[model samples]
Target: MSKKQEPGAAGRATIRDVASAAKTGKTSVSRYLNGEKHLLSDDLKERIGRAISLLDYQPSQMARSLKSGQTRLVGLILADITNPYSVEVMRGVEAACRQEGLTLLVCNTNNELDQEKHYLQLLSSYRVDGIVVNAVGMREAAISTLQQANLPMVLIDRKVADFACDVIALNNVEATQMMTDHLLQNGFEALLFVTEPATVNTRLDRLRTFLQRMQQSPQCIAEQGEIELSNSQGLETLLRDFVARHPDKHKAVMCVNGALTLQVARAMRRLDMTWGPDIGLSGFDELVWADLAGVGITTFKQPTYDMGVAAIGQLVMRIQGNTEPVKDIEFSGELIARASTAAR
Candidate 1:
């Protein structure tokens, strides 16, 4: 049986059609589409432009990119774009790509390994020049397969275990230590570290550093709590239990990131607890809403946009043939103090 014509393909204008209309060869049309107009005379350029306009011809970027061996396209996969950190990072990547005259294919994994794997395969099929991922770290096997393809890749904010690649993230250890020290200096004897789960690299690093710092202090008591993000009631319950457990000491709740900080702050408000004398709160992420929270939340401000730009830079360097040793770039976080962590 004869196949039916696809909806748009029947009237689509091909390079041959454009060349015929322009009274030129297909090679010349292809060159024009690939931004080699300078190689052709002004008269030929005008002819091609007129033909393209007349025919409503849309050149296949993928086909031209394949022939040229550079798509000028980059894939970006984020764990969750709804997070402010992810949004800031994406802005940086987008700005850098615009400056470089490149296009970005952005995907949100939502921390689902299966979705991430699927997007990786899809992006690979598109033949992107490189990929920058703020991974959920659950699909290392699929990522391993991509690594074998030798596509230039950069891991942003999170890294896969044992999968060596270029990584750009905040200095988690130093940032956690700084927050820990701030709480201790503010006369918080008991510190409770709150997080969603220690599933990703950044979370694990911050949690481990917090634990280690608390242990080293000897004078300050340390406790850790994990909140199931899907359950809001559970978070409030967890905070209430934490406060009950540390009734004797001046306690501070240290959130793992901005999201957790907001969660914890809300829970505290719901429980009729205040930030100043009753309980102090501080965490990573210098979110905009942090200051508006009760007595202004103390926070660690990460260079999110810069980190995103830096991640793309590393990926571009690899795409441009940088084959040196794998490097992990860590940007430092600045601690912003406010009434939240004020000494009693």
Candidate 2:
């Protein structure tokens, strides 16, 4: 009778365990595991295959990765997974990874600086082949550590202040220009660019570009208002104040992002302001609730998912040793017109 070996006390099967169960040496079992079964006799191959099924063996990815010098794993760090924009981008990144036969490990930092730093270090320790970042930015110490790891990285939407890695973001200047023009063309002479604060790169870019674009029309009123990201305490007062100050200027509010858009919309609802008739509204990013709002909201739809896929594409090139200069890629936005921005 042939001897059948059981797994050790660790509750796991090792190559040696499979070998013993197959009535063969570890070398034959290893050869079978590494796709060298043709070197062994048909009887040996059958025995090894039977033993593997009975043992329910799974190889250690870490061990194989150490031997091959490539993990075939990618890391994606997101600032806030709950954001609609982040969710769309994640789907794109994940889909591209699957097509490339690579596994993705996602880390959401919840817009926390310390958490972002922690994930940056954690992903590096995992020996991920590449990383995709979509956070406020990176710290100097964390940046140096990643550089030392020699890991390829790509940024989505947000630029690290000092590090010039490959970037996949929207063309803020052009997109802002487009939105401003659309509002002007629709007869909204008083435009107030609304945002959380001009702190992050994306917000600053849009706010600056909107100011510059609005300057061309010397007679029109161009201004900006800031609101706290998480607070809605005085938002209604802010929106109504903008409209009240410009009672005769055909006023409107152009939010710089989706979150701001939602906030402004809710504020409008609270003030009993019918967007199209009372105050014109135009902004960036698509929202599902926009269509159901009083006279659907007009928004500039960003190609967020495509940007996500492009981020991974750039990272893969670096992983393959492109060795070229860092890349800065931007995508244009599509204007999704609705009743909210109609001529009044």
Question: How well does each candidate superpose onto the true structure, as a TM-score?
Answer: 0.86, 0.88
Q: After superposing candidate 2 on the true structure, give the runs of residues whose Cα lies further than 4 Å from its correct spot.
A: 1-11, 16-54
> For model 2, how does the per-residue alpha-carbon lDDT over 294-326 read when each residue is reduced to its tens digit?
889999999999998999899999999999999
Clashes of each: 0, 0
Candidate 1 lDDT by residue in tens digits, 1-344: 12222224567878887787789998898788777888999999998888888777877887768678998999999999999999999999999999888899999999788888888888888888999999877456776658756689999999888887899999999999999999888789988888887888888899999999988889888988887777779988887888898889998898998888888888888999998768998988899988887689899999999998998889999999999999899999799999989998
Worst 10 residues of 2 by lDDT: 1-10
Model 1 misplaced regions, further than 4 Å: 1-58, 138-140
**Residue 109 Cα positional deviation in candidate 1, in Å, after optimal superposition:** 1.6
